[model samples]
Each structure stands twice: as C-alpha cells, then as structure tokens.
Target: MNADEMARELASLGRRVAALEATARPPAVPAMLDQHLDADTVLYAGLGGWDGQTLAWQVVRGWDEIRSAPADASAGVLAALANPTRVRIATELLRRRLTTAELAQRLDQPSPGQLFHHLKELLAAGVVHQPERGTYAVREQHVIPLLSVLCAVLDLRPSVPWEDS
Candidate 1:
C-alpha cells in the first residue's frame, strides 16, 4: 500500500504488542497473602500439618497444585476468639501494649486470677504476644487479619446500636 498507510499500520501493531505485554505480566503480590505463607509455598500449596490419622484424604487431594489455602488464617486464632475473656484481653492489648495487671483491671467481669488464666489460654492460641516479662499485645500482623476474617464468618457485631432520630 502507500508509505503513510504502512507507517500507520506498524504503529497500530506496536500498540497491540504493548497491550499484550501488560496483560501477560503478573500483578503485584497481594498484601493479604504475602508473608502469610512460606516463601516457596506462597505461590502454590497450603501450609498445613496434620497427624496421619487426623487429616481427611479429600482435603489433601491435588495438594501439590493447591496454593496457600485461599487466605484463611490458622485454626488457633479461631479457638482464641471463642472465649469472651480472651477476646476482651486481645482487644485491650491491641489498644496499647500492657502488663498483666493492666489487662486484668480493664476486664470488668473477670477477677485478676481469672484474667491471668485467660491470658495463658490466649498465649497458647498465638493470638497474643509477650514482648517482655509480663507485657502483652495482640499479635497484630497475623492475628488481626485472622480476627477480621473470623468476625466476618461469625457475623459478630456490637450489642447496642444508636437510635436513628
């Protein structure tokens, strides 16, 4: 064809190639899934450990191809949230890092001894962390996201709501 027409066609082809490259490139890593799994397993396969007898066969089918279990946090976080005292303790800890006594005082229902008991339970659940002797805080990076998911799953909500005038 004409010289001008050939130049226009070449430019259109270049634009198409650029668009194709953009579509082919992978997007940025999702924040929710990053650091949530082991480096090698992050892109594919779940991070799970189970006893030989305890694990169901169907669950592990195609395990090699499965990647990261679709962002559901560990079971330990859910267990920690089951207890009311533990949940409150986690909330208080999230507000500010605190010593055992500070957490005890903040929890209205539980006595000091009871609060200590709950703290121990939370520690085992991995939903709370002890930075130093007697100091505790919510395990922010991991447990917070787990709690967010749990809240959505259980449909948790405030007990009272303001009246709309």
Candidate 2:
C-alpha cells in the first residue's frame, strides 16, 4: 500500500482499539448521594425535618461537606449521569411504584437483584424513596430540585442575557 493508504489503515485500527478499550473498562460508577451514610441523613430520618428522630448530627451536613471542595459539586453532578441503567431504573420506579420483583420483570430480566441494587443506590442519593416496605416512589422534594437544576442547565437561552424590548 502507498504511504497515505497505510497511514489511513493504521488510524482506522487505532479507532477500533480505542472503542474496544472503552467497552472493556467499567464505566465510572456514579457516586451515591450518600457518600457517607449517616443516621441523620434524610434518607434514614424519614421525610420529616430535623425534629423527628434527631439522630447524630454531623458538624457540617450533606452538601456542606463539600464547602472546601467546590469542584466536587460539579463532579458529583456530572457523575450523577454516568450510569444510564440507573437513570432508566429510577425513571421506571418513579412512574410506577414497583417492588424489586416487578421492576425486574418489566426490565425483562428473570431476577430483580441488580435492579434492587440500583434502587438502593438511588435511594441513598435521595432521588428515590421507599414509603413502605417493598414499595418505592420518587422523592418529589429531591427529584424536583435536581430536575429543575438540570432543566436550567439544559435550557437553551439566547446568548445575550437581555433582549431589546
């Protein structure tokens, strides 16, 4: 082959190798909302605010833990979208309250074990809630806030903040 043709062939091979590597590596796992699950966490504390059980209170709670690490907030937000499977599972659970079994069936999988794990992760993230045993629902408080934030980010507005009236 001529030099140009050989170079093109090598480039194509490189692209294929890169694609294979990407598929081989485990996609980065999204961080669970509760990086540090605490008794005071709203997930475990019931939807009620501070006065409920009033369990262990950390010096700085939740997002406050990231005060010094501003970058972590952006990273956390980006990581939240890393797993499509989890997102799909969350969407389904939100739409219809499902037991792990039901979710698995809808997913066309024989067992719901993996779906349950994803649900647990989302639960810790505060994106999903368990109102009763084996029943799961989206936590409107948390989900709405996240959705609003996402909408704000994704919403395409004019480049100029103000328009000529």
Candidate 3:
C-alpha cells in the first residue's frame, strides 16, 4: 500500500482501539440488586437530604428476619410520630438543627410548654437529638431510617399522591 494510505489506515485502527478501550473500562457502582438474591430479602435505600448535605443508606434484611422483628421494640419510635405536632417537629428537625425557640416560632406555637411536650416524645424515641444545648436535629444515621418509616406508611395507600408531602 502507498505511504499515505498506510498512515490513514493506522489512524483508523487507533480510533477503533481507543473506542474499545473506553468500553472495556469497569462499570460504576451498582445502584440496585445489591445481591443476586431474587427474593426472600428486602433492601431499603435512600439518597438526598434537606439542605445541601447529601445522605445515603442501604439496609438489607431477610424477609423472615424482618417479619420476626419485635413490633414492641420500635413501638415508641412509631408512637413518637403518631402525633401531627410531633410529626411536624420531626420533619423540621430533619431539615436542620434548631433551638427550642426557633422551632416553636417556626411551628407557630403560642406556648413553649406545649412545644417541649412534643420534643420530649421525640427525644425519648431517639429520633431527634440535641447536638448543642437546645438545638435539635435528626442524626445522620437516622435520616434514612426515618424516611423509610414514612415511605412505608405512605405506601399503605392504594394510590398516594405524587406530591403528598
């Protein structure tokens, strides 16, 4: 072959090799199917959080184990959110840490005594914590778990609205 023709063929071959190299690279982390198990297990994962902070978690458990879990053990946590006022407090805390006064104001409470009444339930349930002084927030680890509980309840509906929250 002529010299120019040989050069052109070499460039074409190089391009094909580069394309192959790109496709041969390892894939990114998988977002689902954490294991090959098709059934008998469950996985709950979440990403995103209030503010710029991002959060993620993946909890896996055997269906049998989940079924066997004691309801009484978590009944307090569930009970904490049962009240609408407490629910609002928990959701606001998930958004950001807030002092008692800030929370009461944001929540529109005329009585600080009533606000503390609600905060007491959350603190006892371990869903919210006081990081410094009176400021309260949902811990990083609890964010996903809290959301998981809410999502489970929301799923109970036959057709939950797209923007229910």
Candidate 4:
C-alpha cells in the first residue's frame, strides 16, 4: 500500500481501539444528589434490582420522615435489636428455627416469661415471627435489610491513616 494510505489505516485502527476502550470501561458512579435535591431533602424511596423477571425492592423513606416518623416505622426495628438478649435471639434464629422453649433453654433464661418478653418485642418489630404455635424465626424478608443497616451503621472500615496502620 502507499505510505499515505498506510498512515490513514493506522489512524483509523487507533480511533477504533479508543472507542472500544471507552465502551468497555465501567460506568462512572453517579453523583449523590440530583440538581433539585439537597442532602436534607434527598431520599431513596426504593432500590430495585432485576434478575430475569424477578424484581426486588428495598424501600426507604425521605430524610425528614426518617427523622420525624413514629417509632413503629424503621426506628422500631432498630430499637427491637438494641438489646443484647434480642440480638442473641436474632442471631440464633438466623442460624436455624427454634421453639420458644428451645430458645429460652439455649439462651439460659431464668424463666419462659422473660424470654417471652424479648420475643414479644421482636414480634412487634417484625424481626421475628411465630411460624406455628411455638416456633419462632427471623422474618425472611428482613434478614438482608437488617444486615445492610447494621453494616452501614457500624462501618468497620478505618477512617484515618493511623487507624489503618
């Protein structure tokens, strides 16, 4: 081929390579806020993910609502989990199903009454459900969301250089 034609062909190939690289690169992270929303006003109403025909939704309310809303909402779940006994109950339930008697014995509670008290709180908060007359287990829908909230709150990653070292 002629020298000029060879140069033109190389330039075309370079342009194609650049275009392919741009397409292959991962998408940039979106900015946290939209033009119309500020930190105080911005809220994620839902996070949806689709796989095949199934769609999973994680719902959240606005920041103001989250701050001011009644305890029966999101706050209730956290409050239910705040106690050591309740946390133990949840962790055990996460592993496998257990009856009230089994849970009480496993936890070494003084009485069934005390275990029932914690269980009631868990039930009201929708963290656990009685599958039948006696068995209790963590609600299936709440497992992932609870873990996500805990992870977000705890945020074990080191924030400072010294901490990392």
RMSD of each: 13.0, 21.6, 6.6, 9.0
Give candidate 1's TM-score: 0.47
Q: Using TM-score as the measure, which candidate wins?
A: 3
| Global lDDT of each candidate | 0.61, 0.58, 0.84, 0.72
lDDT of 2 by residue, 15-118 (tens): 99999998764343233354666654333121222212212211224545444457865565446544776666665754557776677777766556766777
Candidate 4 deviant stretches above 4 angstroms: 1-72, 156-165
The predicted structure with the larger TM-score, 3 or 4, is 3
What is the number of backbone collisions in each predicted candidate, taken in the order shown?
2, 0, 0, 0
Clashing pairs in 4: none
* Candidate of highest lDDT: 3
How high is each candidate's TM-score? 0.47, 0.42, 0.73, 0.53
Q: Worst 10-residue stretch by lDDT in candidate 2?
A: 44-53
lDDT of 3 by residue, 20-119 (tens): 9876642332355646765788888877645565576777889889889899867989898999999889888878889999999899999999999999
For model 1, what is the alpha-carbon lDDT of residue 81?
A: 74
| Candidate 3 lDDT score at position 95 | 80
Sorted on lDDT, best first, the list reads: 3, 4, 1, 2
